[model samples]
Target: MNEPQAIAGVPLRWVGPLRIGGNVATAEVEVPLATYETPLWPSVGRGAKISMLVERGIVATLVDERMTRSVLVTAGDAQTAYLAALEVDARLDELREVVRACGRFTELIGFRHEVTGNLLFLRFEFSTGDASGHNMATLAADALLTRILETIPGISYGSISGNYCTDKKATAINGILGRGKNVVTEILVPREVVRDVLHTSARAIAELNVRKNLIGTLLAGGIRSANAHYANMLLGFYLATGQDAANIIEGSQGVTVAEDRDGDLYFSCTLPNLIVGTVGNGKGLDFVEENLRRLGCREAREPGENARRLAVVAAATVLCGELSLLAAQTNPGELMRAHVQLERKNATTKLGG
Candidate 1:
C-alpha cells in the first residue's frame, strides 16, 4: 500500500446555522453552514436577502429510490430476455414486499428493462427513508437479483450496476425523475438594495443571467444546468459537514433564474440532485457530528427529516453566493478587484504574524 501524503489543511469559514421554516407541520429548524476559506464569500453575504423552504415527500423520494442489477444466463438468448422480463413484470407486487422486508421505510417506486442483443438489462427505483440510499439501494438490488435468479429459469448474474440507475455523474434521468432534495431558494432585492449593496441594477442582473447563464451556457454545450459556480458553495459546505464531497458533481447541476419584477430583482435557484444525508457514513467524526448537532440536524423528529432540513438550507446558501458573484460581474473590474483586495489583506495578516 502507498503511504498517505502529509498536507497542510485549508481554512474553514462557518457562515450561518440560520433558522428557516418549511411548508409543513414540522417546526422551524436551524442549519449550520460553512465554506472552505475564501475571501469572496464575505462579499456575497453583504447583499443577500434570502428565504428558504423545504418540501418533504419529494426529498424522501431519494430514500425510496431503487437500483437494479441485471444478469445474463447461459440458457438465455434474446427470447429468454423477453420471457424473463415478463416474469419480473408479473411478480411486481411480490418483489416490492421482498424489498420492504429488507429495511424500514423502504418502498419500491418502479422498474424498467431493455434487451441489447442477448443481454438483459433490468433497472429498479425505490424510496429509502432518511438515508441517501446508496448502500440501501445496493442491498435491495442484491436481494432482488437473488429472487430473479431463483425464479427465472437460465438467468445468471450479469453486473450489479447497469449504469441505467445513473449515479455520481450528471445525466438527464435524475433531473427528470427527481433525486435528492428539490429545494428552491428565492431572493427579492429592492432596486435600492441592488444599487447600494450589490453595486448593480435589477435589469442588469436579470439580463446577465439570460446572456451568461442561459444563452452563454447553451452556446458552450452545457448539460441540464444553467448556473455559475454552484459547486464553489456546495463543495465548501460538504467538506465542513462531513458529506461525500464527490456528490458535488451531481449536486452542482442546477439552474439560476433572475427577473427584474417591477423594480426589485427576484432571484431563485432550483437544485434537484442534491444527494445528502445526515445520519450515516461520515456523521460519526468529531467535527462532523458537532456541526450536525449545532445545526439542529441531529435532533429532528425522525431519521430523514434532518437531512431534508439541511438540503433546503444548503440550497439557500447557494443562492446567496450566486447572486453576489453575478452582481459583482456586472461592473468591468469588480470581480478581480475584490479578489486583489481580499488576498492583499490576507497576506498582510500573515506577514504581521
Candidate 2:
C-alpha cells in the first residue's frame, strides 16, 4: 500500500459547551472549530459563556433538511418543454420508485422546475439520511434523469447540474426554498448579562444589526443574506468537523436578527443553508470521528437523528459567534483590538515567548 495521506493541520478548538434545547437535541454540547482565524475561539467562547447564564440557554429549532440536484433536458421548443414538465410532474410516484431502487438512504422529497425556451431545468430535492447528501442527491438525480429520458417523449439529455440546484453558490433560490439543514437559533439575554458579558447594551446590538447587517448588506447588493462573519464560524466548524468545507459558501448565506426586548436582548440567527452531517465524505478520519463523538453526533439513533442533532448544534454555534461579533462591533475598536491582542498572544505563545 502507498504511504498514509498527510492532512493539513488547521488550528482546532472546542469553543462552546452551549446548552441547546430542541426536538433534535436537548443538552449541552461543545462545538469544534478548525480555523486559522485564532480570534474565533474566544469570540464564540464568549457567546457560549453568555448562554449558560440564561435559563433556556439557546433554543435551536430544526426547520427542514434537503439536498438537491438539477437535471437539464432539451426539447423541441418551449411548448414541448412545458408539456414534458407536466408529464414528469404527473409521474412523481414512478420517479420516487426509481430513486428508491437507487439507494436505501436516499428519498426523493420533491422537485421544482424552470422552462427556458427549449431547455428544461428539473431540480430534484432529496432526503439523504445522515449525509451532507451531495453525492447521494446526485446519484438519485442521475437515476431519475435516466428514467425521465427513457420515458418522456421528445426530451433529450443535456446536463446533470443545471445550476438550479445552486450547489456551493450564492443564490436567492436556496434561501427561498432552502437546501441542507434549515435551522433557526434564538437566545434571550438578560440586561445584566448583556451589559456585563457582552459589554454592550441590548439596544445597541439590536440597532447595529439593523443598520449594519440588514441595511449595510442591502446597500452592498447582497443576495438574500445579511450577517457579519458567518463564514468565519462556519468554515472553522466545518473544518474541525470534517465537513465538505466548500459547503460553507452557500452555508454562510444566512441572516442575523436582533431585537431589543425592553431592557433584555433577543438575538437570533437563521441559517437556512447550514449544510452539515455526522456521516459521509469527511466523517471517516480519526480526528473527525473523535470530534463528532464529543459533540454527541455519533450516537446510535434513528434514520436522520444524528445529522439533525449536528445541524441544531451547528446553528446554535452560529448564533453564539454572530451575537458576540455584533456586540463587539457596537463599540468602537473592540473588534480590531481583540483580534490584534489575541493573534499576537497566540503567536507569541506558539513561539515559546
> What lDDT does model 2 reach?
0.91
lDDT of 2 by residue, 90-160 (tens): 99999999999988999998889999989999999999999989999999999999999999999999998
- Which prediction has the highest lDDT against the true structure? 2
Model 2: ten consecutive residues of lowest lDDT: 1-10
lDDT of residue 94 for candidate 2 = 92
List candidate 2 segments past 4 Å from native: 1-4
* TM-score of model 2 (CA atoms): 0.98
lDDT of 1: 0.70
Residue 81 C-alpha lDDT in model 2? 97
Q: Give the per-residue lDDT digits (tens) of candidate 1, residues 1-353.
A: 56438522556666632334444223333333455345545754542333222122111112222332333333358888878888999999999988898898667778778777677877777766666777777888888888988988866788777766667777776666666666766666677777877888999999999999999989998778999888888887787677788888878888999999887888878788787777667677777888777766777466567777667667766777788899888999988888888888787888994
For all the candidates, what are their Cα RMSDs to the real structure?
A: 4.4, 1.2
